[model samples]
Target: MMGTRRSVQFGDVITGMLVDGVDGTPYVAATLLVDEQLGVRLEVPYITTSDTAAGETPGEWFETKCPPKNLLLIALEGNISLFDCRYSGHTVRHPAGIAVGKITPADVVLQDRKGDHSDPLEVKELRSDIDGLTEWTGFTAITRHPSVDDENRVKKLDIELRTTDELIWTQGQADMALRTTWSCDSTAEGLTINEGVMLHSTFPAPVPVLTHLEEHRKVASLMTFIFGCPITWRSHSVRDQRFTEKRFSQLIKQNTVKEAARPDPTEKQLRHPLASPSQIGSSGLEAWAASYETWGRFIHPAVSALNSPRTTLENVVVNAAVSMEAAGHLIGEVDGENATYDRRRRKTTATFIYRCLARTGWDWSGICESRVGLARALAKNYNTIKHYGRGDFPDPLETYLVSSTATLVVRLLAIRQAAPDATSEFDSGRHFPAYGRLVEDFKNNGLFIKCDGLFAVSS
Candidate 1:
């Protein structure tokens, strides 16, 4: 029996083995076939090493050719397992970002992390919380990329948000109609990718990016999206109008008495996107009536300077003062009797500006100082223009300082009106070390009488 078995096993083993002869030396290799119940596998069928000679480095360059680095994945029913080079198998990890569900083999993709990041980031949703994705016809996604050098170090990034659809939250279902887009493009001198700023080559960089100014625009746009204001290129200012209970009651009665008021069940209804402010150009006649007479005194110049540019710093100071005046009036307390501009010939004292701003919440320091600085410079430079006095012109630095300050105040006002809730944290109740520009609106009516000897003169 031993002799008969040996003869049969020898024939079978030789058939499975490979024999190679080189230089009178014969090398033999064999493939082992395991039963279904056995859990054995051959890791490296063959290894080639740089240190082939006995005197060479022992384990320096050993590599295997028979065992493969490639993994074979097989999916059956709802389970996926990976098979080894020797046909032994084990389960692999399920990828992230895919929701819990039976994954069909068709959904799998073969990819590695070696592609160029400069390419447009295209994302396709495989699974979503909201059902019927096609219903999101108005969906839009936007990404912004600022310039970054290859090393990816940026001075500061206020925001590098990767967003899909300013509207249409993934978890929430919404329907809205709005269409507007703006892009600015310019070469970045010192910029990079993702150590700070991410790269989006398709979406161009901001146009005419004059540094800090462009950053302001970016913040304003982000605020617009957050506050759910009209998604327009024009930054919408948040106007928080609150009326006291007594005042609200009075207003209701006054409207009712005026005879056009009506209470109707049919009138209380939801609005459609066709008439959505986001879709329609403007909020129409109703909104226009409440808006500024000339956009905004401060914002007008920022968007496009007053048609022709001013040549002098004196003009710049004066412009800042005027913008601050408009902005200051919107915030702080207002005198009911003198709500309108005072008719008397009196310069808007720094004290007056200060008082008005002091009423609102001011979380930032240096703002009042900025305003005062602007006002002081304006008063002096303004005297130069009004009296034709030879006064030193406001230097470029002073001009920019005051201008930026005025811009900040005006922006605050715009932001106050646009995103009132967000501004709550930065209370404008006037930040200190106090400045004289925080003045109350006062007027000197030029009404004075004097008695000289027996006669009285009134001027």
Candidate 2:
């Protein structure tokens, strides 16, 4: 046979051989083909390189097309692995704040280092105890770009982290992973897509300002809240006697005995053997009561009830002294001159206005200001105490002036920004003025009596 007569020999080979053309150009001798038993083969394919001549090279540039940098993947090492596998295509950049899906430690192995198969350098589970210097992989953007619609929006990001290790690959699974859901909290400042730029602008700087009087006002307000006394008390007793002179005497006698027996401090009774005093307003009650007759009618009867308490009178007196001192300090600080109109007659005239205020239970919130308003408040409280100073209201006479004064001084020190240092020497019992004496000469006497018999108040 002309084709195969015992395989007639020809000087020609097929695959991968270069044959010279008639025009003296070299060409591939064979084309690639696949067989069932053997895989498709790569014949001598053309390769373009920098060393190749312009026309002789298959192409001047090689094109490596890969997924955009935004595609994210988690390596078997539990790290994000980004592929810039694009040799040279279009220049794509990743945006900031882009995240990748779950990266488990089971999927990767570390390369480069030598280790046995039994303990190969493989990904490890996350632990609570990670050292500060330990290096762990996380997803981050390769580049940042602003959103077209909103500049704040993140345009693109390579949410995968890269590692020098093998990744766990399945038959058809893509290299990257996607996270469907996660939780996070919003911060006061908005987030940024780019690490270099902060998304939210900084808040305006605060204006320099100063005002300390407001603090003083607050202290005054709180003081009033805890210690305010009622402004007035209405004596609910009804006079039921018929018009008769001798009847008045019998009536007075009967009422006196009845009042004495009941021992209720609230009952309005004649402290003296004579006339009932006029009911005055809360204003100026202290001065009005200074008269022997006026005080005798209220004070004596009231004191009789107090004296009958069947308790330790010494404790009562000490407590009263302390309270009086405290009341004097507070009222004096606000309006000492008005607290006691005359310096010489403070104890006799001014007295502890706060004590009087406490006695009457006046609402102090309404009366707030420097001197005049405080004076009015004091007068109102005092008058209230005198008229309605009965019942379970706190008494200036019953509270210790030392304790009260100490409390007031402590409070004053707290309220004041710069206060003189307090000393144990000042807290001594001997240093405290007597309660009766302090109230008696509040207008005349100073806080403490000096060796020269002068009044001394805290600064």
Candidate 3:
């Protein structure tokens, strides 16, 4: 909680005593559970207290009867606070003190104090780590100091790297930077090097803790789209300028809670990222940041579908298609096209696909031989899945190819709009091996014929 640390995952259950944030009233025994679907919840059971001042008579009290106040759960693992809790339901009540009820919270915060504090902590800076960020950035923090023998042969070598902070983006008074840090350890067997990327944000003035966290999430979303994966926050902390005070808070939103920890992509796996450090350069990243402010509404759906671990093949196709359609309308308007771009009289999906492909100058003929055939196939498949309920879904293989193709198309369009000069690198097979392989897969598998009837008509 002080710095970067492992975050709690779903299905973790912590048992503790529940205390009311206001008036400091201790409630009955409770358990805090995080679920993939149900989200963060607290289960409290009725309790019988013999400390009644009225007499020797014991009374039973249901924690559910307590007012809807922010509650704190003190467990051995850590202290967590539940905010905006409401009574969900309860079980059988005949057992008096043993009946159990549920409380659903709109947000959950870890390592936070009792919620009665009137003055919230002001955040001067926020720092967090995302999975695979180090690899995606292609930055290193390790340096080798080698000592040679008298014969010029290597004798001893020491590895060391200093912590570095590089400015990535600045918007008015607020600026975002990337911090790379390394640690070295000498064990009985050998030495080990650990490196990571920390996303750092500094505000012009002390901002609300929630605002600091929102900024982190927004940047993480943009990185996810660029990296072509679910770049979830591994750990985070909010602190003052001098790091004298540190606070940890997590918002338990639907998207944040359901995110699963995916392993970082290996060097081989990252052979063809949608965007890279060398490709984006320093100035290009700033341009990308600016572009995201305007185009994020068009890009988020595609990013979510492509990166979500639980996304189905059908969802990938439908989401990619919808995102491309929306983005195409904007691109057309930006290019001063005469077509009226509106929801009521919308252009066909094929028309949008063609426009995006043309704008990016992406060579689609390698995949389908004919660009027209490819566009028609994608549009037909998308329309069948989205508009017709009776149509059969595409086979798993064809669906995968179509999803991959759409993802690449989206990336091309994004790069073109953000950093037009970098778009040429995507065409080189030597530069983007993954892109070449995808095209090769389409050629080998004959995706054109398969996608023609991607969604079969039901008899």
Candidate 4:
């Protein structure tokens, strides 16, 4: 009464799995085609992008859903390789990354079709006798099905592994694009209607200052040792040595760390009032990590309100609250030993936290004074906004400057609390001068009116 599924074997269906994410476009690769068995004629679209014309939205200049091409020339750049096994009657399990398992009847059979998807051609199985059948260049993805109902009826799932390293998606890059007009469009003789400026709501991550990244890396490395586990980061090298104490010791013994190549710190820089390595030891790092995410929520605008395209006063005020609460909590619990958060406005919290760090031998007199003023303003505004739901809206410039500086200050203070030695790594070719610079700027300048760059990113 029912037809048995041949393409599916051992709870695994390989033939009918390949599919596009949004459109359900069938994936018919050069060496694999299941359209006939799946009973679907795949329609591939040629997707590309170009400069937006006048009146077009920013980066909205994409050519999508174009007709299928005779052939797709993709340079996967060593990213498009997958392993499989073939069997006359049974299928094998998919192997994990970089592992070559023993071939049993071969895990899965691969086709070697060099023609287009729409082109009619006889299907042939790839054989060892074929020379180029071992390799292919195309998109790679996996599809899984999970039960969706009480009856355990399966719901098909899709995963897309395609990558895009092309778009700049930078503010300055988009700002530089010129507006184009059609030849037939003529200018009005009277008052010209100015085009309304389009704002970017998606907060693209900014690039990190190289110096801060260096310090953060050291702090992160020191953290792994303190936490007794590998820290998850945005990127990593193959077998990263920074997280491995043995490798770090080996590098230090060999004097191979590039940062350490610089002659010994003129005892003055190391012993500088700002460089007291004994200021704060690893006492509350665990708490810092646990609490960092709370304040971090405000710093990352996208996380705070994902649907919001642009920064608002609420974003800034909430961040201010986050910073102040964190500062108050740390200063009261750690420095004052009061066993609870002080629960004050940002200005008062900043003052208390600053004094707390100062008592611990941290030098903050060199910090920029303007930032303190902003903190005071943020405290006052945050109080009004938090309760009344009304305050000065934070423009992009203000959000980038004030929010970033405030968020960093609280986080850096926490890092210092977790591990003071995190400030410098004599063994590794790394230091925390950027952390020092930020401390100096925050204490001395406190200025947010001017910024050398739009924003910073971290790895």
For candidate 3, what is the lDDT?
A: 0.63
Compose the digit string of candidate 4's lDDT tens values, residues 1-459.
322221211122122222212244444332222221221122122222233243221111112212222222122211111112111121223332111111111011122123233332221110011001011111122224454767776675443232222111222211111111111224665433222111111112222122223223333432322221222222110111111111100000011122222232223322222122233322332333334444343223322321222556467446546645555544553443222124542235435434333323333333333333333444544454466565564344434444544443444444454544543352121244544555445445333231122222211
Which run of 10 residues does model 4 get worst, by summed lDDT? 125-134
TM-score computed on alpha carbons, candidate 1? 0.29
Full-model lDDT for every candidate:
0.28, 0.25, 0.63, 0.29
Q: Which candidate should be chosen as best, given lDDT against the real structure?
A: 3
Question: 1-459 in candidate 2: lDDT tens per residue?
Answer: 112111101121123332211244444322222222221221223444455566541121122222122112222222111111121222212343121111112111111112222231112111011111011112222333444436655665444222221112111111111111112345788643321100011112211011111111221222211121101110101111111111101100111112222222321221110101121111112222123232233222222222334534333333333333444554444433444444555453234534333432223221122323333333333333444544443334323332233233222322121112223332232333332233444333333323222224522
Model 1: how far residue 377 lies from native, Å: 4.8
lDDT of 1 by residue, 1-459 (tens): 111110111112111222111134232232322122222122113322333443211111121112222222211111111112222322223342111111111111112111331222122111111111111123323344556667887644353434333322111121111222223334566543321111011112212112212222332232222221222121111101111111101000111111112121121121111112242222221222234343365444432221123334445555545655655555544442122223573435443444334433463332222433334443444344445456665445435444434434444444444334433324533431122122220012211111110111112
Candidate 4: regions farther than 4 A off: 1-317, 320-324, 334-363, 366-378, 384-405, 421-459
> How does each model score on TM-score?
0.29, 0.16, 0.74, 0.28
Residue 350 lDDT in model 4? 39
- In candidate 1 the C-alpha lDDT for residue 430 amounts to 46
Candidate 2 lDDT trough over 10 residues, lowest sum: 126-135
lDDT of 3 at 99: 57
Q: Which stretches of candidate 2 lie over 4 Å from their true place?
A: 1-150, 154-327, 330-339, 342-344, 348-370, 386-414, 417-459
lDDT string, candidate 3, 306-352, tens digits: 56857887788888888788777777743322232235665567767
State, as a TM-score between 0 and 1, how close model 4 is to the true structure: 0.28
The predictions' CA RMSDs to the true structure, in order, are 28.4, 40.9, 6.1, 26.6
